[model samples]
Target: MPNLELLRIVDSIARDKNISRDQIYTDIEQAVASALRKHFNTEDTTEFTVAIDRQTGDISATRNGQAVPLTLLGRIAAQTAKQVLIQLLRQDERGSIYEEFKDRVGTIVTGTVARFDGPIMFVTVGRAECIMPRSEQIPGEEHQVGQRIQALVREVRDTPGGVRIILSRSHPDMVRRLFEREVPEVGEHTIELKALAREPGHRTKIAVSSIDSKVDAVGACVGVRGSRIKNIVDELGGEKIDIVRWNESSQIFISNALKPAEVAEVSLCFELGRATVVVAEDQLSLAIGKRGQNVRLAAKLTGWDIDILTPAEFKAGVDRLDQTLKSVPGVTQEMCDKIVALGLINVFDIEEVGAEPLVEEVGMDADLARRVVERCTEEAKVVAAEQEAKKAAQALAAAEAASAPPQRDARDEAVLAALGLTPGRDPLEKLAQAAGDDAGAEPAGNDETAKLPDPRQAVPGGAPETTVHKEQPVSSADTELSPEEQAVSLPDSGRKAGAAVEHTEETNADTAALAEGRAEPPASPGR
Candidate 1:
């Protein structure tokens, strides 16, 4: 039998290897219980402990507070079982590395390339071995054995075969971690990274802002002259870095997130998770980037669909679209095209009778269409009226320009003479007669002649001069009155006092002649 000192030495070895003494005792107890069950065909109701004496080289098995009877051969065989005990202790010491790092999934960690199993790169991260699959490694970068690399812990799983840890270097979080390590503010919570978007080994955009007013968020991440970001870039195989300022407003954030491109306008539709960004004509290429990488990353970072357009392209598109719409069925080519370009393409879409669509359609907004329709209709009316006026004016000008210096027609002399006007006399006389004016020729400064209203005033193209009333106040007021009142006022106003006295003999002679012509006044004249 082994001495008690040997047992003590074994316990010391187990303790040194971080194995507990109670664990060792428990193992032996289970072994004893198993052995007794096999040998005796009976389950023991009592528990047992393997004890050693320091003074004597004696081994004792106590059951229910008493020692068990055993031969020297059995005792010697059990005492010689130190190698078996050590084997069991070693099994207990093997802890799973996967279990240690499983909680670290979705975070960044450093690892060494352990080996490659065909396409998969086996990496050792701390206590466990994680795998960086071919899909997760940075393209064109080789992972040599024992090469140190930082990667994102993507997943962890345990199967019957063994524990598996999946890793990635292409993940956006990988870049985030690099920034956290290189920038102290990130780790200290002074600067927070709101989102990350990465094109592994190509370019990465990180949206970061500062919780502290004192800290310059982008400045700290970029370091001085971009030293900090440069370090991270070098680690990522010279991947490009874009540090965008974070904004609370998503529109502003997306605008910043799509950096390296100048944005002219950013329109956000949060309900649809979309943003339409309009850039200058020159900035289109930059906003879309080489093969649209910039906008792609911006989409991932902002979690929104980004539609990019150049101002000129958008406008031209709007124009061409409107032109096409003018050709729609049931629409005049010009009107349809105008309204379509205005963004109303369908009959139901016609917001107004003219160029505006009635409802908000895909291309046209309601209010804009309403205004456009009003403007177009109004403009069309003005244009039509102006066209008529221009034709008339041109005709009139042609007639005036074609006239032969106003030589009077000899045939019209009879009519002018009846109206007390001469053929080659004042043009006003011919015009007044042609316009059906009953009043005689206007005398210079004579209120009666000047007050003569123009008959052309009732018709278009009549004399514009007669259309304007003469300055004689009483003539206009008397003309506005009833014929009865006018008749009453005219006689008194028409005769001058001296004219009446001078014309009395002629007036009586005229009356006597009318009486002689009509009645017995002829007999009185004979007597």
Candidate 2:
């Protein structure tokens, strides 16, 4: 009866843990040997041996070549054996889990959000539990307890605690695996996913190509009416995905990579592994995307450093390159055009290529190539300084605009008019009018000097008078102020009170001058 019970227990554990029956029998033999050692108080393992019969599940033991009765091992020995058996069974379970999940790495698995330990989430995937670290979770996505979650098995580690399976939802491969699950062509190898770039929750770009010409890789992946891609987008919490066709040519690939923004031209510089993409001015924002996300992902998907430019900027760069090359002593217009045709868009490109490419590719004399490179290097430095200064000026202007007070608009003017106040009339004039009304005096006239005190009048101590200059007739060259002058003249409100008063007087003067045909009103400063 006891032998039958032992066999039944072994069979049950083997089935539950998915372990081999033979392995369980071996564990039972070791457990019996440990019990015998405790019973005899023998430290030497060689003195005792234990075995379980394969056919009958009968456990037999011997001490120093003498048969030992199993019943005589006592209750304490049986309890010790029980503990050892439980421990061995756990190790076998862990080993089984490790072996099973190790091959599953890079594959997607669906699981329940079992529990959370702070930011780390533990998910139960089939018989094993996996960990999803905070870094692997998609940004702005949250899961509740028992929620269904899908993630890629990024890694499986045989840790001391057990099998540690790490899950990731933010990995680029996660998108690839999701496509394989949603798109049948991908699974059957009819369509190949060449590359993928992702910004977790924001967006993803995947490049695909078809092995069979009739397959239509992108169309098949997208499905009818965007049904297939829609399912993927919903699964990714509405992440915008761009599916682009893959091409062997880098220029074509780059142009396709930056889709939704038509590329006017694509210039490739093989020496630098860079692509200069020119788009129409209207498509510039679309190509760059919000905060440059579009071009950034395109660069990753195509394996090239992408520089996006509008048509005007592209023409300016090419023109600058032509001028710089022509300025070199030995470089003719034909040589410059040849260099530009080689994708040297600007002085920076020539500087990066050095003299070797000029000599080998451009077929220029060695000494002349060196001179050309030297000239280009110096020009590149000057261009870099100019670009840096322009960027700085733009940043400063943006800061000032952000800090300046809001200007009064038509709505504000309407509100003032409703309150019985003139919109554009000066505040000081309003005050003077109130004083005149209280004293029973006539309201001030339109005469400019009578309306306000003269700033040019000297104070009692013969101190230098503060003069308010009238707005001069601004010529085309003097229309815009320098950064330093703008900073000094513009107040926190963006328009100085004195400047406003002077501008009113200047407008009257310009009106008078135009009526007498003395001068054309200075062209309103370009917007």
Candidate 3:
């Protein structure tokens, strides 16, 4: 009897595994032949033929030109057939996946996070589970299981285990794909993406040009009020994107690449493949960006090494080149200007270019060109040495400043000592203790007058004993008295008797203390 059920099973498998029906039928025939060989215990060299009908899926087998029935195969033979069929089906599925994804390399695809194996994430993309390794994942981005994510198909390989599909979130093409998706003009071929540079998770700069003059490439990519770019940024976890209009001119292109910073001038050195960009002093930081990221990405996008400088620096370089060239014998001022005009800005640039350009471009004699190069070479070494020395001096000064001990004011130390606070001791605790002592001290009088203590008297063996009077408050009547009368009413009789003598003695004591490196006065005992 024709087994239409067998054909139905094959079709179902073909649909589920994305394998061709013909391939599945071929696998089944091979499996049946293996089963017959196992059932008959035939030698390895013996051949068994099997065929399956594409319409009805009836199995036919022959051995030694005789018909054989698959039903006669025992349980062991059936198990062998089942194992062989499963292996062949898995191989076919793997091949199908490899073929489908291999062509998709560099294209974007969406998938669900299936699971994680250490730093490797397995995402279910279509019927295949692709892997996104840690290196390919965007920095600071984490994916949860079952979360939908989009990535670039970086690679596809057929291995012994199965098809290995590699996905990348950090690839620069991911941004290109995003633009194509969000901007209709880009996808429709009206706008074209020229170049892109990205520091994944931080920022990206893309250069775009429009085929049609009426449509603005940058404006379209940015959409109305940045509605288009906002989508790409949101998809990249809020990464900043800069869409600049592309230009065929390298100078104009580089200026656009470093947008948000106005360029004062751009000098190109073709031989060195370097672009020296000059911005106003105020715009230097903007041109350089945080940690030179702006200029770095600009270089990558423009395919030229970039050196950002201020107006003053640019002038200095031009002047230095002019001076160095004029210093060389047989080199005239006009030749110097011509050399500077050629974008040879400094002695180093002249030295790097050697004498050929000076001869051919500047119309200088070959021997004179050699002499000019030698002069520039020697000048370059001197300039380099001077710069290195200047850098060393700056570094040394910085190190000294960082390593120097903080200067302590003598007045502050005296105040702290008077307050009974010392280094490495808690100031609050010391102040509390002093407060407690003050609270314990008995009041001298209802109205007390305070006097400044003499350092000479406070010294161990410096001057004769002088009476120290407690401070007393002056009465209202005393305030009305003249200065002479107030002096007469002063309580310190010693100050009136020998004021000059006390001043001389205090001065001597201060001089002695200062000479002994003890300029800070000791705390008075009558706190």
Candidate 4:
């Protein structure tokens, strides 16, 4: 028979783990039944049965409708059964924990520090215990027993100790998981994070791409108002996130990786597996970053040996390094000439050889061999970077010039000319000259070789002495009417027929008047 106290323990454990009460009851009943059947040394137990009352927590074992014999020790046996039942309940609670977190691998979960198991910290995540190693813990990060924390599930495994749920906050997936939770575009199919390079707390560069051309992957991940990424940044305690756009073209991809610094040019030597990036003098410091971090990240992101340069420095470095390699003692003019033939023309070729082999093969002393290798490697880096920078600058300059505003066209030129504008001359000069000129005498701004005015503006027969006859002068009062007004009184076509008839009648009248006036003229004089 199961003890009443044992039933209470089972009920409490079920509540703690949120396991079903029926499942706990079934497990307990089976354990007790198997123990009873084994005690009787019987394989078949049709005559025996065990039952637990739901309301009272009373257990009864019967054989053929009669109670089982209860010795003084049998009472103790019931007590022992109760203890065994409590032990089984604890195991079932742990089993429930395994079932809950087994499917959460690679996901981020929150937990509270339960205890420290030596160097490893044990955290209670939902229902199970998670183990975090000292190495996986953030450096200088402190945790109290009840302080809440978040970590990514590294592994879930079963062991003699119990369910071992390994968790880590410093893992690369921790950042990725956090980003996924905060960014819907990343969680959905719209945008994907292609690759990630991280220096944990310092900084991280995530390469992102969009499946749809219209969707901006970086903008989506950054969220509207920076709220989404701000949440992630807060969760990570302010780790810097630099989101870069991924490209199939390595030149473009590397160019983008070095952010906040503009790449002036990019030149790729595919056979050498190297890319050179040229940046403006102002941007060189930003591209190389503090201690070359920016370029280092770019190198890892693009899988290329990135060399940064400014145009002037690259040409000088390449030339200097080339000359230095040629001046090395063991490096003969014949052998030096042959080295570039083997694609080893640069000072950096010596890095490909180890110190011992360099001495044996190139026949040089150890110290000299090492020095040559070191100098060449260092020089090669500067030279390569400078070359790349120069190339990138040229390319960027070309693109900018192409996209610049277009030049003025022929129509604009004609309009300017009609407005009396001159080409390749100062407008201020023309303005100054115009202010000092006379208006009525002719526009004096025109040079002596300028053309004459149109004749339409000139009065008829009033052109210069060389072109036409001068008209007789008329008093200003009598000449008030213009030529057009004077022509108005004449017939429409000004034909001679109308003028001839009027002239004949006037002439006969004048002749008759003259004859009559001759006789009366003597008498009219005295009157």
Model 1: ten consecutive residues of lowest lDDT: 343-352
**Stretches > 4 Å off in candidate 2:** 395-527
In candidate 4, what are the lDDT values of residues 1-527, reduced to their tens digit? 44678678767877887777877777666556555655665657576676767766666777678776433225445665567676777777777878788888999889999999887999988777789998777666778899999998999887777888899878878888888888887888688888887766667788999999999999999889999889988877788888999999887898899988999878765546777788889999999988888888778777888888898856554567567776566655554444333334346545664456456545667887777677788877876898899999999999999997556678867766776967545556776676666443563342424455576766777855343322333454666757787665443334466465687799687778879885333356556
What are the per-residue Cα lDDT tens digits for candidate 2 across 1-527?
A: 34788788878888888899999888888888888888888878888888888778777888878888898979999998999888998899999888988999999989999999999999999879999999999999999999998999999999888889999999999999889989999988899999999999999999999999988999999999999999999999999999999999999999999998999899888888888999998999999999999999999999999998888888888898888888878788888878877888989899888998888888899999998888889999999999999999999999999998668888888877776777777645777887788899666534443333465664667656344444434343657777887675535334556777897899799899999999976777784
TM-score of each: 0.53, 0.77, 0.78, 0.55
Better of 1 and 2 by TM-score: 2
Error of 4 at 510 (Å): 99
User: What's the lDDT for all of these models?
Assistant: 0.69, 0.88, 0.88, 0.74
lDDT of 1 by residue, 1-527 (tens): 65776568657856565556666665555555445443444556455445544444355666677766544225534543544565565555443345466778878888888999998999987656788888898888886898898888998887645577899988777887778789999999899999888888888888888989988999898889988988998888888888889999888898898887878877654434567788987888889988989999999989998988777755654454454344333334554444444433222223234432234333455554555555445544654587799999999999988984666576677777787665677758567676775465554664444354556554576554443333323565545777886775535545565666667778687788787786334367557
Model 1 TM-score, 2 decimals:
0.53
Please list the residue runs of candidate 3 whose C-alpha ends up more than 4 Å from where it truly belongs after superposition. Answer: 44-46, 403-527
State how far residue 251 of model 4 sits from its true place (Å). 1.0
| Clash numbers, per candidate | 8, 0, 6, 14
Span of ten consecutive residues with least summed lDDT in model 4:
465-474
On a 0 to 100 scale, what is the lDDT of residue 204 in model 1?
Answer: 85
- Quote the positional error of residue 480 for candidate 1 in Å: 99
